[model samples]
Target: MGEPLRGQAAVDQLLEVLDLKQIDAATFQGESPQVGAQRVFGGQVAGQALVAAGRTVDPARLVHSLHGYFVRAGDPTVPIDFHVESIRDGRSFSVRRCTAQQHGRAIFLMSASFQLTEEGLDHHGPAPEVPAPEDVPTMADWLERYPDRAAAFAASPQAVDVRYINSPGWVQPGDRDPAVHQRVWMRIDGRLPDDPLIHACALTYASDLSLLDSVLSIHGEVWGPGGVIGASLDHALWMHRPFRADEWFLYDQTSPSAGGGRGLAVGRMFTRDGRHIASAVQEGLLRRIGG
Candidate 1:
């Protein structure tokens, strides 16, 4: 693996990763963010694939839904090529399938659908009542409070800020009193372009973080030193309303079930004003290291 990017440089690298190079019609090449991880982050691959798919469609048609499967762990040192297939184009909808490959082997696959703006009746359930983002301790706060964890999360390449309302699982293993729910306030670290696709893809990348961890909150699973091993198997996202990635949003997550070496987690993204913007569902493979 290459040396890990740091601070604002890492964030710039993330934007470059998403800014794929168009190699050919319906094909693009995306570079991996050099985050010092052995394998490419699943969310990075997914977000890049979505960007590839979005490039092929008309700007008038906004992405509404995307379903992706993590086929294999990707090599972080290698650049990935994404091939998009035009599945269908309709009067009001369009669909594209994207396959991400490294060394000519498929590592991830996604199907995304875009829809033309349409007005219809709309109503959504109320956002969960939680502490305001201002009231919660920011990541910086956590880092200061628990200096040991600063090195781990501070090294993350993505330019997202995370504030946990509850104690992070890594900090409180064996304390099973925490509920199965996980809530965090997240936002892009800096100002982003006005493009809607950029915001959507940024949200997609951030969505993967702290989602599967919902399954561990109830069990108090830690990440290292005899902690559990897990990876996302599949992910699905549905955009319901427009939102900016640079603005604070609440990611409320819950695990409905966990068994058979797999756990299902679902989450909703709500703006600070309590408007539901998107929903995500993911199934992750979870296995204990030692009995």
Candidate 2:
């Protein structure tokens, strides 16, 4: 079993592993795939761009929004250059635009904003009622239950732990009664930094995981062989409040539509206490091709 580290240390280690300056604008690289169909994981690029934006901001402010597009597939072997453009700086907010490049081509572009919190009235949607993380088995446990898929699951770089609250249709693909909503509990498997932005970025990275699949859930298509090709075309996030990534956060997701080989999924991140923390929207290319 891997020993868990503190959140701060985990974030620090991640920074060390993927230092922004080390990323060459002319010749950048990415981590190799342990599993998945794409050569590079979308979450990695999203997370790295967040980190790049985070590095340029004042720590006192927190990230409240981010939008990105994956214009092209990234080569896992090449380091990615992150060019951060300062969009604006104000007393209460700061904005940045970052473009992730590989092979002298733009692979991903992102815009992120940071804001200093202030006293304000609050209102939010109620938290969805579901099984707690403890009530549900860990993803690792599920993989262990299905030994055939354990190796593939173990090799995945999504070091964060996830436990589904409303389990989607796995045994019955394209058959589960279609519902617009889903929820999951997530947190890093190890420790991470105390910095709020780091936690936000980490969440940004984890947010992409399994979100698009919610659309497929409507069709009973689980991520596996013969499941078909699915890739995020664009992603957007809006942070409403501050929260610790080290703690369990509930991600409630809903898919509004799926058509023409595309699907749109929207989600909200809430603290265990029902405090809304962030919102996300994504559209992915979902197509059933040759197995």
In terms of lDDT, the best-performing candidate is 1
lDDT (tens digit, per residue) of candidate 2 on 1-291: 233332455445555534455444223333433344346777778888887777777888778889999999988766677888888989999998988888888999999888888888888888888777889877766655566665554444445677877563343353355556778898876777677777787788789887886887666676656676788999998888878776888998989898898899998888878888889999999877563
Instruction: Return the lDDT, model 1, position 249.
Output: 94
How displaced is residue 37 in candidate 2, in Å? 7.2
> Which tens-of-lDDT digit does each residue in 1-291 have in candidate 1?
223344466566678889999999999999876546788888889999999999999998999999999999999898899999999999999999999998889999999999999999999999889998889987777667777776666455648878888866666575436677899999887777788998889899999988988998867787555778889999999999999988999999999999999989999999989999999999999888774
TM-score, structure 2 vs. true: 0.87
Candidate 2 lDDT (Cα, 0 to 1)? 0.75
Instruction: List residue ranges in candidate 1 displaced over 4 A.
Output: 1-10, 174-176
The top-ranked prediction according to TM-score is 1
TM-score of each: 0.94, 0.87
